[model samples]
Target: MTQPIAQPAQSTVPASKVLDRVLVLEMVRVTEAAAIGAAKLIGRGDEKAADAAAVEAMRAALNELYMDGTVVIGEGERDEAPMLFIGEKVGLAPGKGPKIDIALDPLEGTTITAKAGPNALAVLAVAEEGGLLNAPDVYMDKIAVGPGYPDGIIDLDRTVTENVTALAQAKGVAPSDIVACVLDRTRHDDIITELRGLGCGIVLISDGDVAGVIATTNEDTGIDIYVGQGGAPEGVLAAAALRCVGGQFKGRLVFRNDDERARAKKWGITDLNKQYDLTELAKGDCIFAATGVTDGSLLAGVKRKKSGVMTTESVVMRASSGTVRWVRGEHRAKV
Candidate 1:
């Protein structure tokens, strides 16, 4: 059984100090809850069921954070999702602590979780109001690399070959030596073809850009760069993670339809294709929490036991001190 961690009382400290404590505990709590929800849907083969469980669990956990946290980018629109919708207020009402903005992916890979595949996770990021971008639910073209590369090494306007060559040159390696991670979707055919032409190795994922972006920061994963179009919400979460690890990421919004374009208008985004730097997605110091729903490079799947279940999470960086923490929790099943 997985058990909830005991939370300390809300502090009357400064906003910075309060954020530090909230980031650590809130992330751990929500991640564990999301893992439990994922575990409950295991073997069900219902993606919506798995996502619903994770969303509900994560929503409840956020309510306990004791801050005036708002869901800047979340599950869906105000009328679309019952919980964690855009502009929804979370955390304690008033007189608590700092007012923050939150962006989350309760179940980053709904299909992956239902299929019990790789790279599925429950991810969330928090920053001060106006710190996190309230991106609409739309596709985003992304290019990312780990720390040490010069700024502007990759941009959305650049061709895949040009970006790959630049990254390879920056790393002092042949183009063939670079490995890029991309979504295994037909839309990425041109990018994939270009990468192949450049002799760069490619790693394909079915879902979960959070894992793809984080993979770039870890040498063992062999994912030198991540280039593809994925959810804008996941892009912000990835930016939060990369911020902690000293990585560089850039994204550009891509709206596929009028509905999506209209949604962008709600956020004051006129140029739907404008590039967004990592800092533009998530600014200042922030905390990012993620727990694997099915298994991934950064964390493991939820472990179910007779009485309860255990879930593991990796926090890329602390908003307060820039420290990373890996947390595991257990919860008992209700009788």
Candidate 2:
């Protein structure tokens, strides 16, 4: 069984005035606890067990927030998954003060957790009501550049080489100075070939596009650009992070199967190729939180012991004030 993290003594923030927003942050902390709980079960080699634990804990945590929140972009649409499904209601039972929009991925990397691979997390982002775009579960082609690259340096429609050359030119550096991250799959062969031909270094991820996209925004990661097809949900979450860090990202939905197209239709999405700027996906003022389930560039995986557990998280930015906080939390197990 899993246990909740020990809550700090009541915050100095007044409950009547600031508690609503503070409750949202606390909700995110609970989700982190849920993810760490599930991660402990990863090494035991049961995928279902891990996902089930995470989903349940995350749902319970969301339910505890004091405001009325709706899942704008969530696990799946109605008839898809139960907890945190799109359109699901969250927060206090009834008559809550403010309404908010929530975007969450209870288990960002189910496979990574199951295989005990690197870079998995419990991720969530919140914004004002109707702030987040309703993203269907589909592939999104994305291109991102770090802060130093002047705006308009990379174009998603441009050829890979063209974009790389443009980035190099914008930075007044040679192509070799750029490091691009892409998914490590055979489908990315052409992208890899083009980058290599341009004298750019490549860092490939086996899974987890969130890490790949976020990597480009951080200086220490050595990733200048992230380009490839990845989960649409992750794209929104990444956009929220990039918003605070002053990076640029553009994404377009890619439908691989009839079912995916059908899903898109339900969302009133007529153009599958329409490009979405980061702001379009994650609208005004978003707070993003993520706790690593396994070790990766941005955060350390949860560590557990008989008496207590320790978890690390990287909170890219808070929509309210655009502050970035990276927190390490330690929880002592109850006797």
Candidate 3:
């Protein structure tokens, strides 16, 4: 006889001067709620609708936190998104709580969720005031690897084969055993061909660059490195995740048009070609949280039961302590 599970409660607020540790699970709630909200829309074949559902839910959850949080990276600019816009302030008592910067993706893989594909996620990154990079929403070229290799083992300036070869040597493994995860797009065809020539294994994802970047950090992922072009906002978010888990990540802004470059300049980016290392992207102590919307590596998808309960899987990380906690929650439907 199985009884209905109790409703999930709030996060554990560990004592700390800064809220990184205390707010770890609070951050998870933001993503978990968004994932749960978006999960209901899965396979509905409406990308925008699903994204909107997630954004609304995430924004509502963040507003309940006890922090003076600003949306540094979010749905879009102030004029673009209704909620969670860049520069928008969240939290119940804005000036009365811990000050922090937030970067988030309400529905990371919108198309994937619409198609019921894998790896869709709801993610958020938090840092003390001025800790996170105020990245504009634009394309960025990125390369990353999990911790344990010497610095400079993989350089973005190098060719794909050269980077893979160097990484294999650093791991002391054969090239064929080194698996790289890259976004599956037409732009990556050349990269794919190059890796194939070098006898490297490649895992291609349709979307969710945040998960794609963090996959390298977990040995279970079997991803030694990740390389490709993705959103700049996501790069900063990924860097924050790596900061908590021990990894090396580098990204450079990629502008497609003069307007894009102009926007970068607006955000105080003086050098278009300057590469940003992990610390440069997310400095000091920070926390990152992500919840899986659909099943994929790194985390599991949200599930619903006949008892009107939903289950969510999430990972929360704090850079100051290098603590990574995986949270599995069962949420009861509101009465």
Q: Every model's Cα RMSD, please?
A: 5.3, 5.9, 5.4
Clash counts for the predictions, in order: 8, 0, 0
| Global CA lDDT computed for model 1 | 0.80
How do the residues 114-149 of candidate 1 rate in per-residue lDDT, one tens digit apiece?
Answer: 888877888888887788888998888899998778
TM-score of each: 0.91, 0.89, 0.93
Error of 3 at 316 (Å): 0.4
lDDT of 2 by residue, 1-335 (tens): 11121111232212223224575457557668677667777767777778778888887887776777788778787787867788888888545556777788877877789889888888887777767778888889999886656667777889888888898888788988899999998888989988888888899888888778888866677788899988898898888766655678999999999999988888778888898887788766667778888887777778776666655554545544545666667766666
**How many angstroms is residue 208 displaced in model 1 relative to the true structure, after the best TM-score fit?**
0.8
**Which window of 10 residues has the lowest lDDT sum in candidate 3?**
1-10
Looking at model 2, residue 204 earns an lDDT score of: 86
Instruction: Show the colliding residue pairs in model 3.
Output: none
**Candidate 3: residue 70 lDDT (0-100):** 92
**lDDT of each candidate versus the true structure:** 0.80, 0.76, 0.86
Stretches of candidate 1 above 4 Å error?
Answer: 1-18, 306-311, 333-335
Worst 10 residues of 1 by lDDT: 4-13
Write out the backbone clash pairs for model 2. none
